[model samples]
Target: MAKKQGLNKKLILLDLVFYAILPYIVWNYGKEPFGDYATMLISTIPGFIYTCYRFILEKQFNIAGLFIIGSLALGTMVNLLSGSAEQMIWNGVYLGLFYIVIYFIALIVKRPFSLYFAVDFAYLQGYARKDSATLFFQKGIFNWFQLIQVVFIVRGLFMAGLTVFLLNKYGIDGYGGMLLYKQIAGWFFWMLITGMFIYINIPVQRFLAGQQDKLQDKKTPLSTDEIF
Candidate 1:
């Protein structure tokens, strides 16, 4: 199970890197093989294919797989439609906005997507959802987990929208400049998200584990002064 979880994490990272950077590759390295639209299709299709291949090999997906596959599919759509520099620059904003809606719905329902994301990653380190083992988050901890999703959605929207505005305002017509700008800005946003996730997720997970144990009469919840 540990091996499978680690493999899942690695697969997700690879997919993110491949899908996230493919546009730049298409605009540069793949430019000669075909034009922009063709190259976009060429680059993105294989990523989805690879994702499918992983599912085939694993025979089942980790909980995070749903969102990972959704992201890949959405990315493929945006890449395919973004044939021009303008489209490439702004399509991502559209996708981000779309996600804001979905994430907002998650918030409304009290099941933030980031909570699932956190649990899935923790699975790599041996966390489990089974009631007999690692306990899932209860109400209070789940609220904190939702905060993670809120922070993520807000940050993603701001960064993506800001990028679109900056590109258009400056008239960055070339793929090179646009892609470079996205790469740098993307790293910035991801860094912020990682930091925020750590701050928000860790304590909540610990609390949830403690609460579960107490309720189940396992170890019983104990006080810890240093809990963040």
Candidate 2:
């Protein structure tokens, strides 16, 4: 259990740094290599490769992998078309639009894409408890998916809209002048994500913990791993 938890933490840190912090760092400093367009390409490439490699290594093609590939493609297009700081950031905006479309489609299908992404990460894309997690997600303790569906859609839209507003007002190059403001806004988005995760999933965890306790008290031979 400790080993798995450590691996999970490492995976999460790798993903966080590559997906968010690294790109931000590169974009903040990469202009020294060539220029803005090159920096944009450089910023996205490492994360894209790392994510793809992780999926290949695990032999699991999941939603997160798909998003990474899609972002890379989008980022490449943005790099090719970028004539200004705004164009450089359009790719990220496109990514937001993609999520918006995906979230709504999942809701239409009554499956809620947010649920899949969360489960995938929780298991670190391993086979362990995947089907069980899917079952649990579909059975959905606390009606978590139903509750979070609207929040996911609205939040995605709000984030995309806010990012566009910032990019337009500040310019991608606004990092040059208003770097702290951009960093603070970036942290705001991260906090929003963290808050939403806790608010939406804590009930599910609590309920599961309750179930585990019941199983313990009943002296059932079954473990939570089996119930997962």
Expressed as tens digits, the lDDT of each residue in 159-227 for candidate 1 is: 777776676676643554555566567666776667766676576667767768787996455668645
Model 1's TM-score against the true structure: 0.63
- Per-residue accuracy of model 2 over 74-193 as CA lDDT, tens digit each: 666766777655665666677678877877888888776556666666667454556636544645452666556667677668767767776778776764433334445555666565
Error of 2 at 117 (Å): 4.7
All candidates: CA RMSD in angstroms? 8.2, 7.9
For residue 31, give model 1's deviation from the true position in Å: 5.0
Every model's TM-score: 0.63, 0.59
**Counted clashes in each candidate structure:** 0, 0
Weakest 10 consecutive residues of candidate 1 by summed lDDT: 128-137
| lDDT of each candidate versus the true structure | 0.66, 0.66
